[model samples]
Target: VNEILDLLYTNLETYPSVRTWVFQKVETVYTLDVRQISGPQFGLCFNASHLHSEKIHEFLYTKLSSKLERDTLALWNLLISLLAPDPSTVTGVRLTKYRKGKRKDNTGTDAVVDYEMDNENLEDGGKILDHEAEIDEMAVHDLGLITVVCQYLCHIASIMAHSTNMRCNALQTAIGFFLEASNAPKTVCELLAHSGMSVSAATTSRMLGPLRSQCEMKLKGLG
Candidate 1:
């Protein structure tokens, strides 16, 4: 995992494009069911739906250690590009510092206009724009990204608390899909198929008891 993360960071320049593809794939899968045309099909559709989901989880976990880190890094890079500072000016500042007795803003009774022309040239070029626009743009982007990541994380937590609470209601959806798939030995087979478990009616009934109790307890606590 460390090696994989290192490799990803080493090639982090490709992250934007990779993130775009991953986001699109995740959205498509979450919105549409891969089980629609089921007959043990295994191809791009399967890989795109399942394998891509796994990859997305891995990438998100690896890239975003905490909410702060993810939001900060993305915003920082966007802001940096938007600001677009002049390299020459930065280099000139460093060079000036390196030259001894060339103190910035030097003052004396006998003064000299050593860099007068340089200052005049810049002044004539017009006012240098501050990065207010870049800061605003970054604020908007950061807010949007943070909102998206938080919403998804909350959704996952909700689903984990109660499988039935999945944002897309996957458990209920699976049950409905299975029932619609077949009718023979209807209830038993359908429940077993949907739940991914083989058991008698009594066991099936008991299986949901704990979950139901948990939901009721959570609701009561909220109240």
Candidate 2:
């Protein structure tokens, strides 16, 4: 475990500056049984981050007890980085040629949805204006990526569900997405599928029993 941590720690000595943002989601319209009409869209982003290695001993000043938290945060960091733009590889508007600020800021884990890669090694010519048309045609299908994003949503939801904030940010975010112009039910499936997690809505409903009830109680308190 120590050896593994040593290696991983060596890789992230410098907090990554790359940004991964989903520029668009590919929408697919189809019909299920009973002539059910549905329109599903996917969330896609262009990443611009890479990995490197260096010394570790200069960083880990604490003992091994912090190993678990360190590893978990490390994994999350790496995972988010993987969603960013890789210069030598990823090209086009996917490289944040015209975006601004970090979408993941107040968005919790939405970094993967709209990360504007830091302009460290790249030149910012007038190309920013040319990106509109290229990025306007955005939409991707990667359920695995969506799954990770959903977890962030769930985490935020769970937090807001219990927090004293009468206005639930997490709940609001979820509701905004689910209640927006998109197909709510199918979007859930799209996100979960991308993450390779399949827990039926029935199962989810059941799991939400306690949370849902608690939320209702809170809502009532606001009155």
Candidate 3:
């Protein structure tokens, strides 16, 4: 899986046309920028955009209709369609105004008090009338399909990028640390490591040692 994903990412980067298409697509929703890195695989980084996910996905489908493998394209299309946001649903946070309903019980000043005599009972109904509705901030939009796709792709990319390099695999390294904290047995640790779910137990222990030293130093400093 790691090798497959890594190959896919490398292919994505190597193809100038694909890179340009991706850049154009993402630029619709997020501000795009390219950054150079010294990494062996990745050379440039770009930002996401502000364009609507629906349009972006549509454009993607149109462009890759004949290019991607039928199964892959079908899966992509299915995922996009399934995750697409409903037009009726709200998309983001916005301030909205609403009125509080009036209550029905209190008497007005003109109503007859026990000490005063009045012909008719004037009702106030405990109504507090305000001309303006209360304003509230709330989320109006559902999560964008494109946003989810981009984030999912990014995480997958991160995992694949570090798959072979456990020393720099932050996600797996964190998982390894969690396993260590739980005192998982060597067999279990090795199983997960071999499965590419985390760094090896040895690497976890090596990392923990430095972290432990730093923690001890901090504690001594307080003393």
Candidate 4:
């Protein structure tokens, strides 16, 4: 299994056939029928149990653990290109030909400047603009990448928790702890738990117990 995963990972970008097959498999898994739980408020909701049987965690550990989190730009680009193969596609907007900026005119008034890329690389010809369109586009791309990464991580964490009672779910655990700190309702915790965004309220209490005890010990010493 590890050998197969390694081969696929190594050849993911090197070979077109491998890339197509891998992406198709990924799409199939993503489209699997999972219980969609909705609440009054609009938020991310997904059933982790549906993905528990899937080998997403195995793929993640074997293929992506080394670099996925560190080099998200590459993942962002890959995802964008895969989802939007054509430059005119919706996701392809991230591939901008020009870097927008600002320059001072003869009258000292700031004018918008578009630094067109000569060959997919930005050249220093004008002062880079820090506001408006460019920043907004960048912000959108960053958020999209973050959302994708976090959701996948959450799925892996939740699956591990279900299959092996694993406590290595730092992302889900953090969300659970945050909910605990916020004194969020048990119903709220349960809702997020179904979505794999957090552990259940009971699990959160168990996880927080040691921390609470340590805090109490420190308070006593200070007192």
Q: Of the candidates shown, which would achieve the greatest lDDT relative to the real structure?
A: 4
Per-candidate TM equals 0.20, 0.25, 0.35, 0.39
Error of 1 at 21 (Å): 41
Off by over 4 Å in 1: 1-130, 164-223
**Among all windows of ten consecutive residues in candidate 3, which has the lowest summed lDDT?**
91-100
Candidate with more favorable, higher TM-score: 1 or 2: 2
User: What RMSD value applies to candidate 4?
Assistant: 13.0
Compute the lDDT of residue 39 as modeled in candidate 4.
22
Model 2 per-residue lDDT tens digits across residues 12-116: 652132111111111111111101100111001101121011111122212211321243343334335555545444443445533422345556564455444
Candidate 3 error regions (>4 Å): 1-155, 164-166, 185-188
Task: Find the number of clashing residue pairs for candidate 2.
Answer: 21
RMSD of model 2, in Å? 21.5
Worst ten-residue run, lDDT, model 4? 33-42
Give all candidates' CA lDDT scores.
0.40, 0.35, 0.43, 0.49
Candidate 1, pairs of clashing residues: none
Candidate 1 C-alpha lDDT tens digits along 99-166? 22234335434343344337654543232223465346546755766566554442332233223222
Clashes of each: 0, 21, 13, 2
Candidate 4 TM-score, true structure as reference: 0.39
How does candidate 2 fare on TM-score?
A: 0.25
